[model samples]
Target: MGAISVKSKHLLGLKGMDRQDIADILDRAAYWERQPKVSDALRGKFVANTFFENSTRTRFSFEMAEKRLGAEVLNFSAAESSVQKGESIYDTMRTLESIGIDAAVIRLKPTGVLEELAGKLNVALVNAGDGNNEHPTQALLDLYTMRKHFGEIKGLTVSIIGDIKHSRVARSNLWGLTAMGANVAFCAPDTMQAPELEHYAPFVTMDEALQADIVMMLRVQLERHDKGLIRSAEDYREQYGLTAERAARMKPHAIIMHPAPVNRGVEIDDELVECGRSKIFTQMEHGVPIRMAVIERVLTS
Candidate 1:
């Protein structure tokens, strides 16, 4: 197996990652995708998947990646551990490190905690998803999918529509894509937009967003919003959803994507999810190799 190199000991977020580093990760992911189902790249290394919040894709993907690379895996769930009885996240991490874990894949509900943990923890830290900060692996998989389909990321117009304020995927994609020379636009209702990102990418109308080469939809994160901020799913769908009509209007070569747990007809039409242009499942398939590349980088870099 080929080695993936990165300067950072921890894969915190993509906010400051250089373009060449992102390209290397994507290229390494492609290599992993084409390899046999398993390898011994990380043989005998101990990695812990520590998730304080609930997850399906990120957790499973990381575990699969770890196993495929022949690493010894420890799965940590907050609810089932001492964390339930008041053990702090830092204490939990330290405990794992004390047990000789070489690296950790963490998903927590709080932002900035990963950065703090990265500083004090001896083991390498990989951010699975932290609050709404960034999910670098997701963005890396996304960039891989885009590149595989389009042959390059440069000059591709990617429109991210829906709940931008609560989407770590969007933030990571924004930072990664822009670094790789893609143009990004945000489209969302006023309450759903992240004003802090105004200087980074313009928030355009839905019609203008459809003109992009890639239309990526985000889940309507009702749990993150104040109750009643979104009056109804129907209301949000009519205004911001990628309905069938909207999908039809997109350019013939344009593709649709969602970092799922899709809300079906809410953020996007149900049928359009598996449509010719949709890369939803393809994105999931890419996650394993993308994460494999990341884990290999962290453990072996």
Candidate 2:
């Protein structure tokens, strides 16, 4: 196996990142936001997207970011491949690497796959999602969006609600939020509570977290359905979801955010999605530029 080595590569996660790395990348992303239309920073470079799991928004977002930066992108969707018949991700990545692909973004069902793949490959690895482990890019973009609204992340109190335990987004946000000096208070029912965050103080009500500067609601993972987790969707929604009454309780300036594919009437009131308070759209919009920064830094730097 020929190693397509860069000076170094970045994996998508927060555990290994120090404060400087986070700040520097965010500064680069801020520069991306200012460029307006597009740039040719990665011109003539080839990027591979190995999506073992299904994704439209994230895939297209990465594609758009790559194309905008003037990089040629190879999208490998699993449906058309032998992955459906059970192909290993390492082999798939090796196959892509056999060609002239320079970098990779992977979405898989297993935690630590990107880190494992990164060690074996020469190219930079972006963890699109690894099971419910962590979605660092989403959290980065979310923070980037938050910085725009809140001036900076320092001291911003962010309340994330919904399927905390099963959400890669939640795990990532918790890390990013704390790293940025933003205190995070995520709320969810015991069923949806994120157990890994045992050290952090958690609230059971959206109202409790809404008391902060931002309320980041995460989407529940329906794909990992377990009957023991819920008696009924409506019942869960009634008890733990963000509702109109809850929305009204937020600081008028408190920015509302969701990673999206939001279950309406579940994690947020529908009105909050449209109101002036919502930063969800901003978070989505920032994904492309933030990813562009990530690809450029991990590949070129």
Candidate 3:
């Protein structure tokens, strides 16, 4: 594995990042994966995990990563914080820094919130997820999982299906995977697809896209569906869900993936979540070391 060299002090997004940087982080993650769980690298440091929106996987994954690195973790809750009384993201971040927090992993409902805070915060800021913008670590762990499976991420066909219009995962994976030379494609219904991404000739049919080496199914984003983007849940499943029929059609070597909090029987078949070819759980398992790499990179550099 290559030596990890990350120049940026904060992990804002994957867009326009050097391919070497991505590889470096993934390499560090691989190293961490083989090491014992507990680490004392950041023993004297303190980090905050602030989530303005609800999350289970990303939140816990980051907490675990921080604790493993021997950093004191401050779990910030939006509902219990001054933010509930109208404190802004900037003030909250600044307050955390004032209290001796070295870095923060933040997730917000607004797209540009993280970027706006990046310039102002004295401490390193990691973007956990910003609205429909991007989730950089998720993409990195995804790359690690792919590399573990195929021995390389380059030259693999990765099809991202469903809710491309509102999926930060799609955006992150699109940029990261393509930067690593993976053939990226998007598949979504007209209402769920981004018009700007039409240049890739996104497959409207699951059959065509499923032929790829990796088939990533995305959640329907029910929160966004309140605006009537989807005609019917049942219809959406029939049209785009990875049913048993579609799952069977995937290449024998092709793997299935979904960033979790999966809408069972919606974006994918429930049975396939643990199917031999499905790397869904493995992806979650990769979250810890991948995030450990990210935390180490941002805090040290």
TM-scores for all candidates?
0.98, 0.93, 0.96
Which is better, 2 or 3, measured by TM-score? Answer: 3
Off by over 4 Å in 2: 1-8, 201-204, 222-226
**Candidate 1 vs candidate 3, lDDT winner:** 1
* Root-mean-square deviation of every model: 1.0, 3.7, 1.6
lDDT of 2 by residue, 1-301 (tens): 1112234476578755666677777888877778867777788899988888888999999999899888999999888897778888788888888888989888988887777788888877888889988888998899888888878899888887777778888888888778878888878778777666868746656557768888877776655346567656676667766787877888888878888978887666677787788877878889988888788877775
Give the candidate number with the greatest TM-score. Answer: 1
Q: How accurate is candidate 1 locally (lDDT)?
A: 0.93
In candidate 3, what are the lDDT values of residues 189-208, reduced to their tens digit? 87887987677535556778
Q: Rate the local accuracy (lDDT) of all candidates.
A: 0.93, 0.80, 0.89
CA displacement after TM-score superposition, residue 90 of candidate 2 (Å): 0.8
Between candidates 1 and 2, name the one with more favorable lDDT.
Answer: 1
Per-residue alpha-carbon lDDT of candidate 1 for residues 79-171, written as tens digits (9 for 90 to 100) = 899999999999999999998999999999899999999989889999999998999999999999999999999999999998888889999
Error of 2 at 160 (Å): 1.1
Instruction: State each candidate's clash count.
Output: 0, 0, 0
